[model samples]
Target: MNKFHGIFKQLFELQLPGTEALDLYEGYYAQLYEALTSRDNYDIPIVMEQARITGGPVLELASGTARIVKHIANAGYSVTGVDISDDMLAIARKKTEMLPQRIKKNITLHKGNMIDFQVDEQFALVILTATSISLLKDEEEVECMFNNIYEHVKDGGRFVFDLLDDESFENSSLRMGGIDAITLNQSPIPKQFILMGEQRDANHSKRALMNFYSEVIAEDRTYRFFGSTEKTYFQYDAILPIIKKTGFKIIQIEKKELAKNEMIYMFVLEK
Candidate 1:
């Protein structure tokens, strides 16, 4: 397993309406989300490539901190980002404020859910990046998102997303302890992010009851974060049936390796 792998993306909250981290740390969690996502930008470049295909508007689900949204807009694409977390949207809005007026005007942030969002017009490209889809409660939510994404996608447009493949899930036991559990610390500022997580069997074998207890020590301040959720774990062969049932038709699927034992399944689908 990648040592810092867990630390980098571990802060991903289950979904919108925010999490206990916000209540405990107030604006602190949003800042951390920006810091972590800004540091790696796990999949922004690939998402931008998709944005380039259609010179039309783009919509991104779970667009936390508007990290991807800002990048796309800076590239001269109009982007509408929808996310549920107020803390995150606030940061996204704040960050865009400093951009050149032209770029700033190209980005829009909406406070909403990925499962059911309303927009008058459809987009030429729809994206769900950063493996945020994994936070969906179950296959049903996944379908709900797909169905909604289908509605938003224009004819001949595409849907692109990546999932952390289940290849490494069998080793969850090795990561269940605490922040003491994983470390990929290379930050210049002394940082302390403790993720207290455990993986346990859910109602279904491919789902896990995830418990989160996190604490963060910033460069000069200390904060605590917390949350609990039951999230779907994906295995390609096992979930293929679910995807096949969606309105989208898979056009291409590929795998990208980030670190040892860490692989992401990137899927491109057409409406």
Candidate 2:
């Protein structure tokens, strides 16, 4: 029976929804996303700390699952989270339902594209963390996003975000592999996942193809595999001009080492 159940599970996960342009995190995958990322994303507290220093109403673009937005709201800032994924927004709303009234009242989630979103009021602090700015497919898209971010910020307000440094990606291996575990609702039945991937430069563009295969193993030792391929392009020199053209003045750009083999670039911009 366990063998049969595993087979069914594999088939289900194999059919999970995704597109060349976007990955749809719904149903079982939604649960998996929550399980994988519910922990303190070090970026959350970092952004929250900045928000406290800068003051708010704050805005977070591509705010997946409200992980960071929730922290800002709970820290007593009014925050708005915007994303294009209904599945992600659904999970965020469900989680918000359990928050205290004060915190719940402080957070607002909107379904919109980051390149073209509008709000009634401007914010003192705007952020896009966790390398989400890489999701824009090209320079034109990045310009549009920066323009929107510019319009959303109050004069002298700060815009904060993180991205992969060009040197890190240029020096990275073409292929890599890793393993991680996802514990569902703190249940003992942990799901082990593996990632194996390669990166290749895209033709005539600074963008590159990030292709990967992922396998998730169930408690019964049954497993499923999912594949993803996306375009990512962000270089400090390439992006800085766009930010300046969109009316942002660079305040600081710093490199932080997270691990022996991993590093990130943080940007602070002012309008």
lDDT of each: 0.69, 0.70
Q: Candidate 1's residue-wise lDDT over 1-271, tens digit each?
A: 2211233235453432323433311365456456655755657776777777766699998888887888889998888999888888887888899899999989888988989988777998999877777778677788888888898999988898888777665345433443334332445435555454545353366655444445555565654455444456666775577677876888778787663345778888888
RMSD of each: 6.6, 6.4
For all predicted structures, in order, the TM-scores are 0.79, 0.79
The sequence of per-residue lDDT tens digits that candidate 2 reaches over residues 1-271 is 1111222234444565431112435444555566667774657656766787789899999887888888898989999999887888998999998999999999999998988988888999999976777777888988988888888899889999888775675325432322223333344336544343434443434454443233444555544444343546477788878887898998877777654344678888988
Q: Which portions of model 2 miss their true places by more than 4 Å?
A: 1-27, 169-171, 174-192, 202-205, 211-225
Scored against the true structure, residue 164 in model 1 reaches a CA lDDT of 71
